[model samples]
Target: MRTLRRSRSRPWPLGEPTSPDGQISTVDLLLVRAALHAGATPGQAVTALHDRGGVLDTTARRIAAGEDLPALALDPACPGGPLVRALAVAEVAGAAAGPVLDGLVDGVVRAAELDRLVRTRSAQARLVARMLTTLPVVGAVGIAVFDTGARTFLTGPGGLVLVVVAGLLVVVASWWMRHLVASVGRAVRDVDPLVVAMRRIGRPAPGSVGVPPTPGEGLPTVEALELLAVSLAAGMPLVEAMGLVARLGPPAVRGQLRRAADGLRAGLPPFEAFPEGLAEAADVIDISRRWGAPAVASLRLLADDLGRRAAAASEAAAEQLSVRLVFPTTLLLVPAFGLLVVVPLVVSAFSGFRLGP
Candidate 1:
């Protein structure tokens, strides 16, 4: 029962979304795939898309209605920015839309899952930060409500000094914990510490989160594999693909890709062509090519696995964060509360005892 807009002279580009506002989303890809499977022409599929008002839909409509696809896709406003870049490369390189799109869909699914995992895993740490922050405000309000002399104590001899010290502790501790949480959370997310340090050196390019080539870890290898998958899917030779990767990948891995490409060109097998930590990705490409298996699918699976490992790392980091926050956070708050609320009430009570006697 889906409608098709077949009357348009140019059929919608196969596997390419017709455009709209800059809001491209994964759900848009799902819709496009569904429409294509349902025998809808590309134009009809664009018209059939339900996200007409979203970023992806708007961008898709623009592309369908004759806007420049590559320029628009690379525009910062493009929805599903990373996915659009992938599609743009496919369009430019004449890659088969089916394999490319299938890989893209899998990548998006994994990204969404990773996002959800991070949110769930970070919940407890965020909650603790929130609770600790609220204590000072709550203590202030409660003391004012229950203790009539609270006003006197706060405004009295050492009252101003007490107020200043307590305020400083609460403010400083809140700021410290917040900064720590963000830093540790980023570390868990596989964010590069070096890049974080270089934040003041001007912004990094968009969609540039290729893993830094840390020794022996999985992220760098996974990134290399995914790039190789794209090149192979585009029909590039392994040697040429490695060379392209060398030119385009993160600075940390370029030398490795270059050496691998040189080795490949020298008639070495992929397993031997690659450097330490990258041989596995090279082997994957070689084996998959030899068997004529879909390399894109294998790369997508590797990306999914890397995402899971990052999530696990984030969870473990959050657990450690919970332990680290306890003593420092608690000690700061407990003293402030005692000075601001408990000690003030106790002083007032002793004064009352003397007057009553």
Candidate 2:
């Protein structure tokens, strides 16, 4: 068995194997695929990364010339590392590499969509934050240096201190808010996860709508689904597919699926055999497969859902930021506005009244 497994993983026969914060541009992947289909070597494909004759293109050339393409595909830094890993596994299992690549392309498209949502939303938040930041400075300058009635009052020692303190607080608050928003954005993004959803793993589901929160949490589901899809495509039974993933998928979620596969083979209820979440997922996949839904297509849908979930997480983080901004904004802007705009008007009114008397 070990010898057979080793032989199967023996690097892909092809010469080569192998983010924005979330937009999906197929131009690069498409370019690579086109090159490969046209019989270009891995090195050749990478070198053809088009007008981008810089470090990236150079890196691709060097890797193709020097490193083992199959081995490098598993590296996190590799472009489409996860997809390459999937293709490698599919090749080993005797599945059609072309079909697997198609599945991978679908997954990448979904991931890109998720990235786009996160990036755009964060940018909007950043723009809003930036606009607010300039408020105190503009207001301060207007009152302190421009308004004649307020010139004397603002230039006084007491007024200068108020202006200075307000300016400092506003600056600090704006900086802190920007940092907080960025931190929140980073928090939502997770590195590639291992476990994937089952129903969605093998069967290509339809395009999903609306991204959900915490894409990382759903990745185990995506991993599981992708494994099942590949195994099923290769003609493995449901239990067999589950067992295969338990062995090959990320260690974090593997054991549970392994136990479930074992129990399932022994005639236990499918739902009772696996871990809670995985079991539910596995059960759904089992039912759907039996219902005649193509495993790959269904799994594709699952993958899309997971992508949406990631977008949702980013959105949630962005919403939380707006709430967080409230405290600092009130502390800085309100006081600055009142001190700059309201105070002068009140004082000027009183001064006019006294003169009339």
Clashes of each: 22, 34
Query: Which digits, one per residue and each the tens of the lDDT, describe model 1 over residues 1-357?
Result: 000101111211211111121323466667766775676544344455534665456656676777654565435334444444444444554564445456556655554454455556656766777787668758877887788787678778786688788888888777666655654435532532223323433443233433332221224344456556677778887787777655444344455667778889999988898765564465666788799886667765765565565557656665566676676477787777777887778877776765433
Query: Candidate 2: how large is its RMSD?
Result: 11.0
Least lDDT summed over 10 consecutive residues: which range in candidate 1? 1-10
Say which candidate scores most in TM-score.
1
Displacement of residue 311 (Cα, Å) in model 2 is 4.9
Task: Estimate, for each residue in 1-357, the C-alpha lDDT of model 2 and write its tens digit.
Answer: 000000011111111110222222356556656775786655455556645552235346546576544455434334433444454455445665555545555655655454466556556556667767777667767765666666666677866776777777776776667666655444433322322332224342222211221222225455666766787778877777777666554334554567777887997766677666554465666687579775566665665565466556666775666676777678777786677666765665565565433
Off by over 4 Å in 2: 1-25, 36-59, 107-127, 148-157, 168-220, 235-279, 285-297, 308-332, 340-357
Evaluated against the true structure, the overall lDDT of model 1 is 0.56
Candidate number with greatest lDDT:
1
